[model samples]
Target: MAFHLRPATDQDLPFARALTYEAMSGYYLQYGLMWSNDGFDVAWAGRENWLICNDNAVLGFISLSRDSRALYIRELHMLEACRGLGAGSWVLEQMALKAQALGVLRLTVFKNNPARRLYLRSGMRIVGEEHCFWRMERVCQSS
Candidate 1:
Protein backbone atom coordinates (compact mmCIF):
# COMPACT_ATOMS: atom_id res chain seq x y z
CA MET A 1 0.00 0.00 0.00
CA ALA A 2 1.20 3.48 -0.83
CA PHE A 3 1.48 5.87 2.09
CA HIS A 4 2.29 9.53 2.41
CA LEU A 5 3.77 11.50 5.26
CA ARG A 6 2.98 15.17 5.42
CA PRO A 7 2.75 18.19 7.68
CA ALA A 8 -0.63 18.24 9.32
CA THR A 9 -3.08 21.06 8.64
CA ASP A 10 -5.72 22.51 10.94
CA GLN A 11 -8.41 20.27 9.51
CA ASP A 12 -6.37 17.23 10.55
CA LEU A 13 -6.12 18.30 14.18
CA PRO A 14 -9.19 16.49 15.41
CA PHE A 15 -8.17 13.24 13.74
CA ALA A 16 -4.66 13.69 15.04
CA ARG A 17 -5.90 14.11 18.58
CA ALA A 18 -8.02 10.98 18.27
CA LEU A 19 -5.08 9.07 16.90
CA THR A 20 -2.99 10.27 19.83
CA TYR A 21 -5.52 8.93 22.24
CA GLU A 22 -5.66 5.61 20.45
CA ALA A 23 -1.89 5.25 20.46
CA MET A 24 -1.10 6.56 23.95
CA SER A 25 -4.01 5.51 26.10
CA GLY A 26 -2.76 1.96 26.43
CA TYR A 27 0.62 3.03 27.72
CA TYR A 28 -0.76 5.71 29.99
CA LEU A 29 -3.39 3.39 31.27
CA GLN A 30 -0.69 0.95 32.33
CA TYR A 31 0.55 3.59 34.72
CA GLY A 32 -2.92 4.57 35.84
CA LEU A 33 -2.82 7.83 33.94
CA MET A 34 -4.81 9.22 31.05
CA TRP A 35 -4.45 12.22 28.78
CA SER A 36 -7.10 14.87 29.07
CA ASN A 37 -8.76 16.11 25.93
CA ASP A 38 -7.83 19.62 27.02
CA GLY A 39 -4.14 18.68 27.11
CA PHE A 40 -4.37 17.10 23.66
CA ASP A 41 -6.20 20.18 22.47
CA VAL A 42 -3.37 22.38 23.64
CA ALA A 43 -0.68 20.14 22.20
CA TRP A 44 -2.38 19.77 18.87
CA ALA A 45 -2.64 23.54 18.71
CA GLY A 46 0.98 24.17 19.58
CA ARG A 47 3.13 21.41 18.16
CA GLU A 48 4.14 20.41 14.67
CA ASN A 49 2.21 17.22 14.12
CA TRP A 50 2.71 15.04 11.09
CA LEU A 51 0.40 12.37 9.82
CA ILE A 52 1.02 9.15 7.94
CA CYS A 53 -1.81 8.00 5.76
CA ASN A 54 -2.66 5.68 2.95
CA ASP A 55 -5.74 5.65 0.75
CA ASN A 56 -7.77 4.35 3.64
CA ALA A 57 -6.91 6.24 6.81
CA VAL A 58 -4.26 7.72 9.04
CA LEU A 59 -1.87 4.90 9.97
CA GLY A 60 0.54 6.76 12.24
CA PHE A 61 1.65 10.15 13.52
CA ILE A 62 4.63 11.96 14.95
CA SER A 63 5.20 15.39 16.48
CA LEU A 64 8.36 17.42 16.86
CA SER A 65 9.81 20.67 18.14
CA ARG A 66 12.85 22.14 16.50
CA ASP A 67 15.40 24.78 17.28
CA SER A 68 18.42 26.04 15.38
CA ARG A 69 20.51 22.91 15.96
CA ALA A 70 18.15 20.06 16.73
CA LEU A 71 14.64 18.68 16.54
CA TYR A 72 13.19 17.01 19.57
CA ILE A 73 10.67 14.32 18.66
CA ARG A 74 7.89 14.71 21.17
CA GLU A 75 5.67 11.87 20.10
CA LEU A 76 5.62 9.06 17.52
CA HIS A 77 2.78 6.60 17.44
CA MET A 78 1.66 4.06 14.87
CA LEU A 79 -1.73 2.48 15.13
CA GLU A 80 -1.88 -0.93 16.81
CA ALA A 81 -2.81 -2.46 13.53
CA CYS A 82 0.20 -0.91 11.84
CA ARG A 83 2.86 -1.92 14.32
CA GLY A 84 5.60 -4.34 13.17
CA LEU A 85 5.22 -3.05 9.66
CA GLY A 86 7.68 -0.55 8.14
CA ALA A 87 5.50 2.47 8.90
CA GLY A 88 7.46 3.52 11.96
CA SER A 89 10.75 3.30 10.16
CA TRP A 90 9.37 5.25 7.28
CA VAL A 91 8.37 8.05 9.61
CA LEU A 92 11.84 8.12 11.15
CA GLU A 93 13.46 8.31 7.74
CA GLN A 94 11.21 11.18 6.79
CA MET A 95 12.12 13.02 9.98
CA ALA A 96 15.84 12.47 9.36
CA LEU A 97 15.55 13.77 5.84
CA LYS A 98 13.70 16.82 7.08
CA ALA A 99 16.34 17.42 9.74
CA GLN A 100 19.09 17.14 7.18
CA ALA A 101 17.39 19.52 4.81
CA LEU A 102 16.99 22.02 7.65
CA GLY A 103 20.63 21.63 8.76
CA VAL A 104 19.60 20.15 12.05
CA LEU A 105 22.39 18.31 13.86
CA ARG A 106 20.35 16.07 16.11
CA LEU A 107 17.02 14.64 17.23
CA THR A 108 16.20 13.29 20.68
CA VAL A 109 14.12 10.35 21.87
CA PHE A 110 12.99 9.38 25.32
CA LYS A 111 14.81 6.61 27.22
CA ASN A 112 12.18 3.98 27.68
CA ASN A 113 10.57 4.46 24.33
CA PRO A 114 10.83 1.32 22.21
CA ALA A 115 11.16 3.59 19.24
CA ARG A 116 14.66 4.28 20.55
CA ARG A 117 15.61 1.06 18.77
CA LEU A 118 14.31 2.47 15.50
CA TYR A 119 16.22 5.72 16.04
CA LEU A 120 19.38 3.83 16.92
CA ARG A 121 18.99 1.61 13.90
CA SER A 122 18.62 4.71 11.77
CA GLY A 123 22.06 5.90 13.02
CA MET A 124 21.10 8.05 16.01
CA ARG A 125 22.93 7.35 19.26
CA ILE A 126 22.51 8.17 22.89
CA VAL A 127 24.34 11.31 23.93
CA GLY A 128 22.86 11.77 27.39
CA GLU A 129 20.06 10.86 29.75
CA GLU A 130 18.06 12.93 32.17
CA HIS A 131 14.89 12.45 34.16
CA CYS A 132 14.52 8.93 32.82
CA PHE A 133 14.69 9.96 29.17
CA TRP A 134 17.57 9.28 26.83
CA ARG A 135 18.69 12.01 24.49
CA MET A 136 19.85 10.69 21.13
CA GLU A 137 21.70 12.66 18.48
CA ARG A 138 22.12 12.10 14.77
CA VAL A 139 25.34 13.62 13.57
CA CYS A 140 25.34 14.16 9.84
CA GLN A 141 27.69 11.76 8.16
CA SER A 142 30.40 13.17 5.93
CA SER A 143 30.20 11.76 2.47
Candidate 2:
Protein backbone atom coordinates (compact mmCIF):
# COMPACT_ATOMS: atom_id res chain seq x y z
CA MET A 1 0.00 0.00 0.00
CA ALA A 2 1.15 3.53 -0.72
CA PHE A 3 1.55 5.96 2.16
CA HIS A 4 1.05 9.66 2.65
CA LEU A 5 2.56 12.12 5.10
CA ARG A 6 0.77 14.87 6.95
CA PRO A 7 1.90 17.37 9.52
CA ALA A 8 1.49 15.96 13.01
CA THR A 9 -0.68 17.59 15.65
CA ASP A 10 -0.85 17.54 19.46
CA GLN A 11 -3.06 14.46 19.35
CA ASP A 12 -0.29 12.53 17.70
CA LEU A 13 2.01 12.69 20.74
CA PRO A 14 0.68 9.59 22.47
CA PHE A 15 0.81 7.62 19.25
CA ALA A 16 4.22 8.93 18.28
CA ARG A 17 5.70 8.23 21.73
CA ALA A 18 4.22 4.77 21.86
CA LEU A 19 5.49 3.93 18.38
CA THR A 20 8.94 5.28 19.23
CA TYR A 21 9.13 3.29 22.44
CA GLU A 22 7.99 0.16 20.68
CA ALA A 23 10.70 0.55 18.08
CA MET A 24 13.55 1.61 20.36
CA SER A 25 12.90 0.21 23.82
CA GLY A 26 14.75 -2.98 23.03
CA TYR A 27 17.79 -1.09 21.88
CA TYR A 28 17.70 1.08 24.98
CA LEU A 29 17.61 -2.01 27.18
CA GLN A 30 20.42 -3.66 25.25
CA TYR A 31 22.55 -0.55 25.60
CA GLY A 32 21.95 -0.32 29.37
CA LEU A 33 19.94 2.84 29.01
CA MET A 34 16.54 3.76 30.38
CA TRP A 35 13.75 4.69 28.01
CA SER A 36 11.81 7.74 29.04
CA ASN A 37 9.27 9.95 27.31
CA ASP A 38 10.23 12.78 29.65
CA GLY A 39 11.20 15.50 27.24
CA PHE A 40 9.21 14.34 24.24
CA ASP A 41 6.73 17.17 24.42
CA VAL A 42 9.36 19.85 24.68
CA ALA A 43 11.34 18.35 21.84
CA TRP A 44 8.30 17.61 19.75
CA ALA A 45 7.27 21.19 20.00
CA GLY A 46 10.60 22.20 18.60
CA ARG A 47 10.81 19.96 15.55
CA GLU A 48 8.85 19.27 12.40
CA ASN A 49 6.82 16.06 12.58
CA TRP A 50 4.80 14.18 9.99
CA LEU A 51 2.46 11.26 10.35
CA ILE A 52 2.82 8.41 7.89
CA CYS A 53 -0.57 7.22 6.85
CA ASN A 54 -2.23 4.89 4.39
CA ASP A 55 -5.67 6.33 3.98
CA ASN A 56 -7.15 6.34 7.50
CA ALA A 57 -4.60 4.04 9.01
CA VAL A 58 -1.69 5.64 10.80
CA LEU A 59 1.36 3.52 10.03
CA GLY A 60 4.06 5.61 11.71
CA PHE A 61 5.69 9.00 12.03
CA ILE A 62 8.83 10.87 11.06
CA SER A 63 10.44 13.72 13.00
CA LEU A 64 12.95 16.12 11.51
CA SER A 65 15.04 19.22 11.99
CA ARG A 66 17.34 21.01 9.57
CA ASP A 67 20.30 23.34 9.38
CA SER A 68 21.83 25.10 6.42
CA ARG A 69 23.94 22.06 5.66
CA ALA A 70 21.66 19.13 6.33
CA LEU A 71 18.22 17.82 7.13
CA TYR A 72 18.39 15.63 10.18
CA ILE A 73 15.97 12.77 10.61
CA ARG A 74 15.40 12.81 14.33
CA GLU A 75 13.05 9.84 14.25
CA LEU A 76 11.33 7.39 11.93
CA HIS A 77 9.30 4.56 13.36
CA MET A 78 6.86 2.19 11.73
CA LEU A 79 4.49 -0.30 13.24
CA GLU A 80 6.02 -3.78 13.52
CA ALA A 81 3.42 -5.22 11.19
CA CYS A 82 3.92 -2.39 8.76
CA ARG A 83 7.63 -2.83 8.20
CA GLY A 84 9.39 -4.65 5.33
CA LEU A 85 6.68 -3.28 3.10
CA GLY A 86 8.69 -0.36 1.65
CA ALA A 87 7.35 2.33 3.95
CA GLY A 88 10.73 3.05 5.48
CA SER A 89 12.34 3.26 2.08
CA TRP A 90 9.54 5.39 0.79
CA VAL A 91 10.01 7.73 3.71
CA LEU A 92 13.72 7.91 3.06
CA GLU A 93 13.09 8.74 -0.57
CA GLN A 94 10.73 11.50 0.49
CA MET A 95 13.25 12.79 3.01
CA ALA A 96 15.99 12.73 0.40
CA LEU A 97 13.83 14.75 -1.92
CA LYS A 98 13.18 17.17 0.90
CA ALA A 99 16.91 17.42 1.45
CA GLN A 100 17.82 17.95 -2.19
CA ALA A 101 18.40 21.65 -1.76
CA LEU A 102 19.82 21.24 1.73
CA GLY A 103 22.84 19.30 0.41
CA VAL A 104 22.53 16.35 2.76
CA LEU A 105 20.27 14.19 4.88
CA ARG A 106 21.45 12.73 8.16
CA LEU A 107 20.38 10.50 11.01
CA THR A 108 21.71 8.37 13.82
CA VAL A 109 20.66 4.82 14.43
CA PHE A 110 21.49 2.30 17.12
CA LYS A 111 24.61 0.36 16.19
CA ASN A 112 22.74 -2.87 15.74
CA ASN A 113 19.42 -1.60 14.54
CA PRO A 114 18.31 -3.62 11.52
CA ALA A 115 17.12 -0.40 9.97
CA ARG A 116 20.73 0.45 9.29
CA ARG A 117 20.64 -2.00 6.40
CA LEU A 118 17.69 -0.17 4.96
CA TYR A 119 19.56 3.12 5.31
CA LEU A 120 22.56 1.64 3.61
CA ARG A 121 20.45 0.36 0.75
CA SER A 122 18.95 3.81 0.47
CA GLY A 123 22.42 5.31 -0.04
CA MET A 124 23.24 6.57 3.43
CA ARG A 125 26.80 5.94 4.58
CA ILE A 126 28.13 5.87 8.10
CA VAL A 127 30.26 8.94 8.60
CA GLY A 128 30.90 8.68 12.32
CA GLU A 129 30.29 6.50 15.32
CA GLU A 130 29.09 7.27 18.80
CA HIS A 131 29.30 5.02 21.83
CA CYS A 132 26.14 3.17 20.79
CA PHE A 133 25.00 4.61 17.48
CA TRP A 134 26.17 5.19 13.94
CA ARG A 135 25.80 8.64 12.45
CA MET A 136 24.82 8.39 8.79
CA GLU A 137 24.41 10.78 5.92
CA ARG A 138 23.31 10.75 2.28
CA VAL A 139 24.50 13.61 0.18
CA CYS A 140 21.67 14.85 -2.01
CA GLN A 141 22.10 15.21 -5.74
CA SER A 142 20.89 18.51 -6.99
CA SER A 143 18.94 18.38 -10.21
Candidate 3:
Protein backbone atom coordinates (compact mmCIF):
# COMPACT_ATOMS: atom_id res chain seq x y z
CA MET A 1 0.00 0.00 0.00
CA ALA A 2 1.18 3.52 -0.82
CA PHE A 3 1.64 5.82 2.17
CA HIS A 4 2.37 9.47 2.69
CA LEU A 5 4.06 11.39 5.49
CA ARG A 6 2.41 14.04 7.59
CA PRO A 7 3.28 15.76 10.83
CA ALA A 8 1.85 13.77 13.70
CA THR A 9 -0.64 15.51 15.89
CA ASP A 10 -1.28 15.16 19.60
CA GLN A 11 -4.35 13.05 18.96
CA ASP A 12 -2.18 10.60 17.07
CA LEU A 13 0.41 10.19 19.78
CA PRO A 14 -1.19 7.33 21.65
CA PHE A 15 -1.78 5.32 18.53
CA ALA A 16 1.78 5.90 17.41
CA ARG A 17 3.20 4.94 20.76
CA ALA A 18 1.06 1.84 21.08
CA LEU A 19 1.93 0.78 17.58
CA THR A 20 5.60 1.22 18.34
CA TYR A 21 5.34 -0.90 21.43
CA GLU A 22 3.39 -3.57 19.63
CA ALA A 23 5.86 -3.59 16.79
CA MET A 24 8.99 -3.60 18.87
CA SER A 25 8.40 -4.90 22.38
CA GLY A 26 8.86 -8.52 21.49
CA TYR A 27 12.02 -8.01 19.54
CA TYR A 28 13.59 -6.13 22.40
CA LEU A 29 12.60 -8.80 24.89
CA GLN A 30 13.79 -11.58 22.63
CA TYR A 31 17.19 -9.97 22.38
CA GLY A 32 17.38 -9.40 26.15
CA LEU A 33 17.73 -5.69 25.54
CA MET A 34 16.80 -3.23 28.25
CA TRP A 35 13.91 -1.05 27.18
CA SER A 36 11.44 1.43 28.57
CA ASN A 37 8.78 -1.17 29.11
CA ASP A 38 7.80 0.76 32.16
CA GLY A 39 6.50 3.73 30.19
CA PHE A 40 6.81 5.91 27.09
CA ASP A 41 8.14 9.35 26.35
CA VAL A 42 5.20 11.27 24.98
CA ALA A 43 7.09 14.52 24.99
CA TRP A 44 9.58 13.11 22.56
CA ALA A 45 6.83 12.51 20.03
CA GLY A 46 6.15 16.15 19.43
CA ARG A 47 7.05 18.03 16.24
CA GLU A 48 9.50 15.52 14.87
CA ASN A 49 7.03 12.65 14.66
CA TRP A 50 5.75 11.84 11.18
CA LEU A 51 2.91 9.49 10.55
CA ILE A 52 3.03 6.99 7.73
CA CYS A 53 -0.54 6.98 6.57
CA ASN A 54 -2.74 5.91 3.72
CA ASP A 55 -6.44 6.50 3.16
CA ASN A 56 -7.73 4.47 6.09
CA ALA A 57 -5.31 5.06 8.95
CA VAL A 58 -1.75 5.32 10.14
CA LEU A 59 0.46 2.36 9.52
CA GLY A 60 3.36 3.61 11.60
CA PHE A 61 5.54 6.54 12.59
CA ILE A 62 9.07 7.88 12.10
CA SER A 63 10.92 10.65 13.95
CA LEU A 64 13.64 12.93 12.63
CA SER A 65 15.69 15.95 13.57
CA ARG A 66 18.80 17.63 12.31
CA ASP A 67 21.77 19.81 12.94
CA SER A 68 23.78 21.73 10.32
CA ARG A 69 25.93 18.71 9.66
CA ALA A 70 23.57 15.78 10.02
CA LEU A 71 19.96 14.62 9.92
CA TYR A 72 19.10 12.25 12.73
CA ILE A 73 16.44 9.59 12.48
CA ARG A 74 15.31 8.66 15.96
CA GLU A 75 12.95 5.87 15.07
CA LEU A 76 11.23 4.27 12.13
CA HIS A 77 8.74 1.57 12.94
CA MET A 78 5.76 -0.16 11.34
CA LEU A 79 2.85 -2.14 12.73
CA GLU A 80 3.30 -5.89 12.84
CA ALA A 81 0.99 -6.58 9.92
CA CYS A 82 2.66 -3.85 7.92
CA ARG A 83 6.03 -5.53 7.88
CA GLY A 84 7.38 -7.08 4.65
CA LEU A 85 4.88 -5.01 2.69
CA GLY A 86 7.55 -2.49 1.61
CA ALA A 87 6.12 0.42 3.56
CA GLY A 88 9.20 0.67 5.74
CA SER A 89 11.45 0.80 2.71
CA TRP A 90 9.25 3.44 1.16
CA VAL A 91 9.41 5.49 4.36
CA LEU A 92 13.19 5.22 4.48
CA GLU A 93 13.46 6.20 0.82
CA GLN A 94 11.39 9.27 1.48
CA MET A 95 13.51 9.99 4.55
CA ALA A 96 16.64 9.78 2.43
CA LEU A 97 15.17 12.25 -0.01
CA LYS A 98 14.16 14.53 2.83
CA ALA A 99 17.65 14.36 4.30
CA GLN A 100 19.53 14.75 1.05
CA ALA A 101 21.52 17.94 0.64
CA LEU A 102 20.95 18.65 4.30
CA GLY A 103 24.12 16.69 5.19
CA VAL A 104 24.73 13.16 6.38
CA LEU A 105 21.67 11.20 7.52
CA ARG A 106 22.26 9.23 10.68
CA LEU A 107 20.27 6.63 12.62
CA THR A 108 20.73 3.81 15.08
CA VAL A 109 19.12 0.43 14.77
CA PHE A 110 18.95 -2.31 17.35
CA LYS A 111 21.71 -4.67 16.42
CA ASN A 112 19.14 -7.44 16.16
CA ASN A 113 16.53 -5.50 14.24
CA PRO A 114 16.01 -6.49 10.64
CA ALA A 115 15.55 -2.86 9.61
CA ARG A 116 19.32 -2.52 9.66
CA ARG A 117 19.27 -4.46 6.40
CA LEU A 118 16.74 -2.04 5.00
CA TYR A 119 19.01 0.82 5.98
CA LEU A 120 21.92 -0.93 4.36
CA ARG A 121 19.89 -1.59 1.25
CA SER A 122 19.04 2.10 1.19
CA GLY A 123 22.79 2.83 0.99
CA MET A 124 23.39 3.57 4.66
CA ARG A 125 26.58 2.09 6.07
CA ILE A 126 27.24 0.94 9.59
CA VAL A 127 29.63 3.44 11.06
CA GLY A 128 29.77 2.46 14.73
CA GLU A 129 28.24 0.43 17.48
CA GLU A 130 27.27 1.08 21.07
CA HIS A 131 25.95 -1.59 23.37
CA CYS A 132 23.44 -3.56 21.32
CA PHE A 133 22.82 -0.85 18.74
CA TRP A 134 24.58 0.01 15.50
CA ARG A 135 25.05 3.55 14.28
CA MET A 136 24.44 3.82 10.58
CA GLU A 137 24.71 6.73 8.21
CA ARG A 138 24.03 7.67 4.63
CA VAL A 139 25.95 10.53 3.06
CA CYS A 140 23.94 12.32 0.44
CA GLN A 141 25.95 13.98 -2.27
CA SER A 142 25.54 17.71 -2.37
CA SER A 143 24.13 19.09 -5.57
Question: Highest TM-score among the candidates is held by which one?
Answer: 2
The whole-model lDDT of each prediction reads 0.74, 0.93, 0.80
Give the candidate number with the greatest lDDT: 2
Give the TM-score of each candidate.
0.77, 0.96, 0.85
lDDT of 3 by residue, 1-143 (tens): 66888888778767867776776788788778555733456445433888887766777888787889888888788877777878888887787787877868899888888888889998999999998889999987657
Q: What is the C-alpha RMSD, rounded to one decimal, of candidate 1?
A: 2.9
Across 20-90, the per-residue lDDT of candidate 2 in tens digits comes to: 98888899889999877877777788999999989888889999999999999999999999888888999
Q: What is the lDDT of candidate 1?
A: 0.74
Using TM-score, rank the candidates from best to worst.
2, 3, 1
Give the runs in model 2 whose Cα sits over 4 Å from its true position.
none
TM-score computed on alpha carbons, candidate 2: 0.96
Native-vs-model 2 lDDT? 0.93
* Residue 94 accuracy (lDDT) in model 3: 83
Models ranked on lDDT = 2, 3, 1
32 Cα displacement, candidate 2 (Å): 2.0
Better of 2 and 3 by lDDT: 2
